[model samples]
Target: MATEALGSQAAAQDRTAGFGRLALTALRAVGRVLGRVFGVVRPVAWVLIAATITLWIAGQSLGWWELTVTAVVIGAALLLCLLFLIGRTAYDVSLDLNRTRVVVGERAVGALTLSNTGTRAILPSRVVLPVGNGRGVFDVHRLSPGEQAEELFAIPTSRRAVVKVGPVSVVRGDPLGLFERVHRRDEPVDLFVHPRTVLFDGQSLGFLRDLEGLPATDLSPDDVSFHALREYQAGDDLRHVHWKSTARTGHIMVRQYEETRRSHFVIGLSTSPADYRDDDEFELAVSVAGSLGLRALRDSQRVEVRVQERALPAATGKQFLDALSGLEHSRARAGGIVELAGSVAASLALASVVVLVCGTKVDANDLRTACSRLPFGARVLAVVVSPAGTAPSLRRIGDADVITVGALEQLPLALRKVLA
Candidate 1:
């Protein structure tokens, strides 16, 4: 009797454990399914129900069918929402933009190809892409994994802004179209929207470039493109005298060299949100730095971009501009932009011009010292982007020109003046 009782007890314990596991598994599955079901209909569900009931009161038998069909339309909408949630929205995507450039006020067209990889062809859906304005929603109704869909969007920014346009959301609806399933696409892709460049105040950059020689130069050179000619003088080199001009005028003329000087401008950007006056102000500062850096590059002088999050080395290449585009703020000020270009990496401090994007005034002293240490050729220019007008101008620390800009749209034009 004791052995039989023990066996029965063991059997009962095993049955209980099995049932518990089965119950837990059922609960988990039900939770997921129900969550999906409710998520689909929760938006405007009451309105949809009210409409269905009103139709029924009017003696429309098809109203009932509409309600039932909406509930059953789960397959299509659910599939789409699943695509976004699971991050499997597209099989492939491409960024189609010109590598060289598109001028300011010109349209920039980028194409993306989303291929369906699933066995069944996808029906109708919409994707929210990241354009310059913080969001770009694309409509894709039909396509299979192997098939491709072409979409287009306009970048409404005249200034250079890094546009990151990916991780689109795919939304689907039930058969009756009463419910929508939201899916967050997992694909990681982005577009770097460069700031639009323009000639400022009727100042021709081409003339400067040609007179100064190539767009990239560290030292100034002397070459006679065109300079005022003078009558042949004893001190003038005979080689410079033009025999043809001498014959035409019956007097010797010497070719004079044009004097072109290189600009010394430095631009520093900060990504620490804590320092910025506000979201818009910080973004404007970044845009200003980028615009100035590009212009300095074209001027045949070294341009440096130092962000609190990342620092670009001095004597840097042009590619650093693109890198600056995707800059983001950090949680801690562990790596200070001022220190990176100052005590830590002082060699990068060599510049004839300095531009600091003021977030907070924490590193104001360090930046000031760096600018002062530079030769007389270098002058530091600072811009304050504080929303509440709290950020102090750098003039307190040194002889720096400080401008408080209210918006990022003002950055490009402002930098143009500062550089001038």
Candidate 2:
């Protein structure tokens, strides 16, 4: 009998524990739901709720009918806000860019599509686009069930940059502006605005006689430019054996020729804001670099463009332009022309020519220091763009040939005179 009584007591204790655990779980779930409800409530909604409670307390204490009626009106407003907050409208949003890349001054158009996929109709709302540092807002009209609306917009391309367009947000609020809700949808897209470039008609080789490929200097026995006849080597091509020369000299004579050397150019652009007197000068420097680099690539010369500590991949045609399009002014002022020149020299020691594009703020001494780090026998050209619109001048600083131009349009003319 005592054993039975003990078993009954143990079973009763176990049941009580289980009931306590279930009650705690229910409380936790209710707390979470309330937490979310409070999280989205705006300050206005909170103020109205507080006003309703205060009015109700005053009405009970003073027994005033006016206070009670005011309390009831405030409570109704709060209830409406809650109803709007709990019910979310279903929307399908998509953004499409006409082109992912464009040149400066070109129009960049984007299409936005918003479709209502819910069974009920959705009221009018505003769609906001986060563009760069600004925001673009478009009004979305009332969308019926299964209805779709499209909006076409243009992005500003006043400067060379990579503009980010997206993470669209839909804003819904009451007519009285008492409450508001925002829902973010869709990812961002990048638009590349390329710097302007110009074509130049001038020789790429400067003053390097031995390295000059234009007048082909290196002589080979079986190349394009015929030189003089020489005794045929064991491995000389039989087709190149000059029969008349061989017979006259009483020996196997082969044709001699000069082989052309290919030009490999390295372009370094200084992006530090300290290097330029103003934004215009920095933009001109970028344009000059792009123009020169593109011109070299067009002539089939191997080209490498470097900005700050980063080296753009060696490419040609559209690929090269795409790299130039994404170049931006450096935000940090730590690395400037001197450091960039040293880095470029270290990595591209065998480059045929090194071109440095900078602004007027960089003096002749800075140019000298940058040129001194380049490898021996490599020609260096320093282009300084001035914001003062000064006449272009060409002078020698240390081992580098300096060309100073005021406007971007003067780059081609300056290059022809200096590179001629």
Q: For residue 172, what is the lDDT in candidate 1?
A: 64
- Candidate 2, residue 348: CA error in Å? 0.8
lDDT of 2 by residue, 1-420 (tens): 999999999999999999999999999999988876665677877888889899999998999989999999988877676565444556799999999888899989989999998898888888998988998999988899999999999987888888889988888777655666778898999888888877767555433334445335557765566778889889989999999988898999888887654477889899998899998998889888888877777667888888886888658657766777777778675588898899888898767789999998888788899999886667789999996969988999987889999887888888777767
lDDT of 1: 0.57
225 Cα displacement, candidate 2 (Å): 14
Instruction: Flag regions of model 2 displaced more than 4 Å.
Output: 1-39, 54-69, 85-88, 117-120, 202-262, 314-326, 331-333
Task: Tell me the whole-model lDDT of each prediction, alpha carbons only.
Answer: 0.57, 0.82
lDDT of 2: 0.82
Say which candidate scores most in TM-score: 2
Against the true structure, what is each candidate's TM-score?
Answer: 0.44, 0.74
